[model samples]
Target: MAFINGPVPEALDREVAATPAEFERDLRKAWPQGVRSDASLSLELNDGALRLTILLEPLEPRRIGLLTLPRLCARYRFEGGDERARTALLTRLDRAMQRGGG
Candidate 1:
């Protein structure tokens, strides 16, 4: 009944330079319990009361000079969860998907 875990969004969208397969691997690592839906290219992580659906949309590769990078659009939908729950879960996912170096 108070603002504790900061602000939580019902949905989040992010564009990353990674192929579907690559991102899927990270998704699995982040939430192994999550189920993958190949048909829709989405992942569903649910704990009955708390649910999160991740939609992966592949886009044209970005070319910089002679380099081409894979592109993907990731949409995260927080179906049911508290601020702390959502924040904690998202943090794990973000940490798993995070990449370093230029």
Candidate 2:
């Protein structure tokens, strides 16, 4: 796994378990509409905060069911970074992680 350098916010860590919807709301605002899909979405607590992970289905119609490719998965930490900035960062990171073998 590719590692990112930084500290996760403790408040987020404490709040994630019970505040999943709020966390997702923040994540959705940070994510891009084009990349968002009708796929599995989950929250994970790691280090000291809430992480968002997505399991993406194949975007290609032909390859979706026939080809058993890996799911486009990504993990993100919602630290106290700027909401706007982190949203863009999350989108880029998601794409990168998806292409970089999770």
Counted clashes in each candidate structure: 0, 0
Q: lDDT tens digits, residues 1-102, model 1?
A: 012246678887888888888887777877777665677788788865778888999999999999999998888888876877887777767776677766
lDDT of each: 0.77, 0.37
- What is the per-residue lDDT of model 2 for residues 36-89, given as tens digits with 9 covering 90 to 100? 334255543222232333432223223356764332223344554455544545
Model 2 lDDT on a 0 to 1 scale: 0.37
Report the poorest 10 consecutive residues by lDDT, candidate 1. 1-10
| Residue pairs whose backbone atoms clash in candidate 1 | none
TM-score of 1: 0.83
**Candidate 1 lDDT for residue 89:** 75
TM-score of each: 0.83, 0.25
lDDT of 1 at 82: 85
